[model samples]
Target: MVQGHYESLNRKNDERMNAIPYCDTGEVFEADTIANVWKREDKEWLKRTQSDRSGYEYPRLGESPYINMTDDFRMEKKVICQDIFWSCDGTSFVSVHNDFGIRQYLVPEESNTDKLNRNLLLPFTRFFRNQSIVSCAIDPFYTLYNENSDRLAGDRIVVGGKNFPLQLYSLMDGQCILSYDTMNKINGEYETVYSVKIDVESRVYTGSCRNKVAIYDKSRRDAVWMNQSTKKASKGRQSIISCFEEQPMGGQALSRGSLLCGSYANEMFQVDCRHQRLERLNYTRTVAGGIVQILTSDNGRYVYVVRRNSDAISIYDRRNLQHELNVLRLPFRIHHNSAKLKAYIDTAYGLSMGTPQGTILNWGRDLVEFGGVPSHNSVDDPLITSIPPESEWRTNLSSTIPATVVKNCPGDPELFALSHGGTISLCRFGG
Candidate 1:
């Protein structure tokens, strides 16, 4: 969660109330307009099928000229906003706005990319304004389970500090599912949900404030909270950050299903999600910056992290959970704003793989697949390429180097990067 999540710029005032289903691959269903439903070769429901779909539609990749970020590749913006998340099975996808509502955009797999967009798409479902807002700046966290496709449960979204109350709601019989007069108890009854991140199965949530770290387990309805001491370290992995903007920027689980988080301060933290324990992986503080994103493997094997303020990335293998095994520094001042990453897995080798010892480069919108790895054609920018796919901000860094030394100018690397200003970067890891 480096910050900026996706692409696009137009912010619409229109809101919808519905759940639309889209598939990236029809392997899931023989749907005319279905969602989350498909029977696999094993006869298992790939998901449940809901033929009647709805939402704000977006164009498919290459459907319009706006999608062509580069000549070799092009993907439609799909949705107008990019602060949140999106998931697909190849046929269609569900796009969710923080408070505006959710929309389903379809993709006729065989349909030409040049003919896709909002008009070409249809709304399968929509969530109304009472439960949602036309523009309340809702930071919805999304996840898809083994059973259901991706969805915006509204279970965990970052609402500001305690000054602003968070109202939790669930839909039932087309009514206020379970709206609660939210309270940010973390800081005093005045706590605000600064940052919220959920695990793969929608089981855990990591929420933060100015200097505290709180983890809530939905399964147990349990939580762990901690904070930092700037004047002096109070000890025991307390806060996610040791400084201000350098405070905890983001936290994510690892490829092995363990937790990893970065702070604007000099810190990166890890915890074991399966056992509901803090693994406290060994992480060394550097001048590089704070951690933005935490990506774990489906089976929880490998972990990838990016530090934006300092232009660095931490690559960790479960074996070295006590501390970072390797650190990556880049050439140009990594354009921390817009970044994305994808990791390839040789699953046949087993889920507990080790070491990212390979010549791996990933780029583009598809989060596509390459040799046993996931990759996509590059977006039209050299700066980003120089920064490294996952989260290397500056260029010209190496594992062989003693340590990153701050200089007044940018270092030279064979690669350049994109100027797109995205605070967040997406990295594919594990499953």
Candidate 2:
């Protein structure tokens, strides 16, 4: 593997340590079926892509198509817009624009088909560029519904960066059911809503990059208990590096935290969610780093994160920040593979993805597959990758195909959602 010799904190920084071994779930995910993927890239259409170099190219469609990566994953579709809602029944979908517009469609299933089942939906989208909708939540916000035909979506939503504009949506038609712009009400607090999560009891929890926290109940829809900013104790700037939802969904209580942004020269701290606030927990393999992306398992079994400047992924126990599970490092040689090369690490349990510029090394703990799509800048070949390849246990939620290419499989409720741009993939790991 490319990553090894992690520095030790028990002593001075430069003290190297050996990697510890870990165990896999040993169960394979499966796929009952596959379907075409479609998406709009960065708001624009992209070049066609395929598994085969000479494979057919994909194209853009106006109507809402269920780019099902697999049967279990959420549908993958882009608004060709921002501040929009895209939802589908088994065969068709309705697209709602933020300017109060809507469109319906039955997309063609073949790459060669250009005609869209236009007017499939009524009230076309009145989308306008740069509408001020979201104040915090990341682009491509994750939307959820209680069921397939529920006209109203999002009983609860994780909005804003965390709570700048805590807006709730009525998925039935992308209606703004509620807007709790908490920052305006804060007592002159420096708020950068980093992350927000929902609980079953209809309460909202907002986490800010500045180490501040707020919890609101749906009954009140008001920021009842606001924890003072954590940085109030220090005279320095702190960034809410990253945020995520804690495990065990659907309780009256809410618990979540973030990694403060700064130089990776220090260890990351796990927030206690409430007044215990931010606790310092640095890696003995000291790199002085903060959090990157926070990826949690569906069941919240493991919380995985990639540390800064290092290509390694850290496994944490998530429950109480008890101990570090493993540090997975990809190899340099694998990443150095020739351009136009593709590497995939598909095991019974998981699949590691790489672009043309990167590599996928480390099966158990070392470089196994080499090279990813070369440099995200220099585009040679558009790589289409899928994870937890449609096995019996996980076939529903993973597929990554470029949108321009139209192919078909005989299935419905497509579990896979296309990536929306370079790779029209609607795939992911799901229950």
On TM-score, the candidate that comes out on top is: 2
> Candidate 2: where is the Cα deviation over 4 Å?
1-158, 161-164, 184-190, 228-237, 246-289, 298-301, 319-323, 331-414, 420-424, 427-431
TM-score of each: 0.44, 0.45
Model 1, 1-431: lDDT tens per residue? 11122211101101111111121222322222111111121132111233225553422211112222333221211112223233211222343332233433333322223211211223233332322221122222332222334544543332233354433332211223322233555535745444455444443344444445454443333354433223322343334432111111122322334445555444555544445333344455555445544544333444555555444445466566555544433333433453322122222211110111211222221221121122332434222221224321222122231211111101111111111111111111210
lDDT of 1 at 260: 55
Evaluated at residue 338, the lDDT of candidate 1 is 31
Worst 10 residues of 2 by lDDT: 20-29
Model 2, 252-346: lDDT tens digits are: 12223342221122234553444445455543343424443444433344555544444455555556444665544433212212221121122
Residue 246, candidate 1: how far off, in angstroms? 21
